[model samples]
Target: MFRNVEIALASLYVTTTGVLIAGIYYVHQILGVEQWGIIAFLSLIMTLVVGGILAKIAITPLREHFHHLERFSKETLHELNLPINTITANVQMLRKSHTDEKSLKRLERIEIAAEMLKERYNELDYMIKKQSEREKIEHFDLREVIEERLVFLRSLYPSVTWDVMIASYVVNCDRIGLGKVIDNLIENGVKYSPKNPIITITLQDNTVSIKDQGIGMDEITLMHIYDRYYQSDSTMAGYGIGLNLVKRYCDRYGIALHISSRINEGTCVKLEFKKKGIVDG
Candidate 1:
């Protein structure tokens, strides 16, 4: 799509610029006053045509970008599918073989991670068709998920405050999507917040909230919170896919995803969970 636009714009620029210069020369030396007005109008039209050509040229890089991302998405899907199955099956095998306490515990975490990867692969497969029958849902421990992601988030945002409540929120959710949503929220809060500012994460009754006392959002950002590539602040590190995943999980599990923020103050993200309720709920 962008490639076509680029080509069209580039063609327009060449045609318009050529015409405008010729028209001005004709109006100044060859044409009289009456004809000059017509020539000038033609020149103006020529400029617009030239602008279109430039737009086409500018769209070349965009076309390449779109192609790269699309191809990457397809290639990665093929690569990730096999690994997901292998890991999930291996995890199940380990779980059965492990009878000791530590072995059982380690296998449990591996099983959870494997389960998440399976859902992620399924999401990739269902992305285009959006097959409702292949939906991935399960009861997830929010604390475990948060802890798993904390190691990564700490690396991403070292200065921001890190807080996680010592409780379990076994909410009915899609493990992969839920983990991605929460990870995105926490990372967003950490990235946008002022250094050393308090980032609070609290859980109660299956509701988990991540609040940050950092650069707050205004009406515009708040309105399009989950919009793709919406990085109004320029400082935050994401293309807005984070909150989008959050929204996805929210829709999948019938949970509430709320956001409130103010400039120079901070933002609060609330993830409402279904209390052991099924996905159909």
Candidate 2:
């Protein structure tokens, strides 16, 4: 709405100025006097006053509406987090207690549901953080971070087998942003793969590659993979924001990304980070 208003006002200003200039020149020619200068100044002043009034009128409701939405989103997210955290914590405690196999399986399912909600919440949290916070740069070991994420993912998808060959390498990056990139890549590999899938991750010479034996894509589907809300398989569970966000983070950090896939075979994604001048321990 605000963008529309800005464009409209800009067009109005351009059109109005052209007409006023033409009118002033013609009036000056007709009257042959200095009074036309005063007329032109008054006209400009009136136009500015009217434009300012219109802008204020158009913007007030839009401003209020956004404020309301922001407030609602914040409050609702807070409420959602409280229950999710409580359920997750309680479920973990239950896992340590004595329980039958059937009950344990049920609890495991509940935990998976909670974790899935947490992933959705994380996506929302990622977006909110992108808007409100500056990226934090820190030196860290990429191998350690990948290992940590893999631990979490393994619990989520126990049926999938992982082959990791990442070497320790220091990198300067935003931890949260990079974590999201790794999480989304691994999550996609796990989610898209068939039962008992094999996903391989290798890090070498500042390049990290994740390969999965899954239902691969055609060239047409792969072309639009980076597009937001563009999913090759609509029936799969996702908002299609994961790959788009991964691309966004990679671009922001000067990382090079590549993808290779063959239909019914698998998909391989690679990210190469920019090299730092020196490796610091």
User: Top lDDT: which candidate number?
Assistant: 2
Model 1 residue pairs with clashes: 6-56, 9-52, 9-53, 9-56, 10-53, 13-50, 13-53
TM-scores, one per candidate: 0.53, 0.79
Q: What is the C-alpha RMSD of each candidate to the true structure, in Å?
A: 10.7, 4.5
How far does residue 180 in candidate 1 sit from its true spot (Å)? 0.4
Kindly list the per-residue Cα lDDT of model 2 for residues 1-281, writing each as its tens digit.
76876776676677667666765765577656578568778667766766676667667768777788777877888899999999999998998893899989999889889987987787677666677655567788898889988877888888888898998777887777788899889888878888899999999978899999899989999889999999988899999988998998887778889999998899999988778512221
Give the Cα-based TM-score of candidate 2 against the true structure.
Answer: 0.79
Residue-by-residue lDDT tens digits, candidate 1, 150-224: 765664454666776747766665666666677678767777866676788888776788999888989987888
Q: What is the C-alpha local distance difference test score of candidate 2?
A: 0.81
Question: Clashing pairs in model 2?
Answer: none
Model 1 / residue 202 / CA error / Å: 0.8
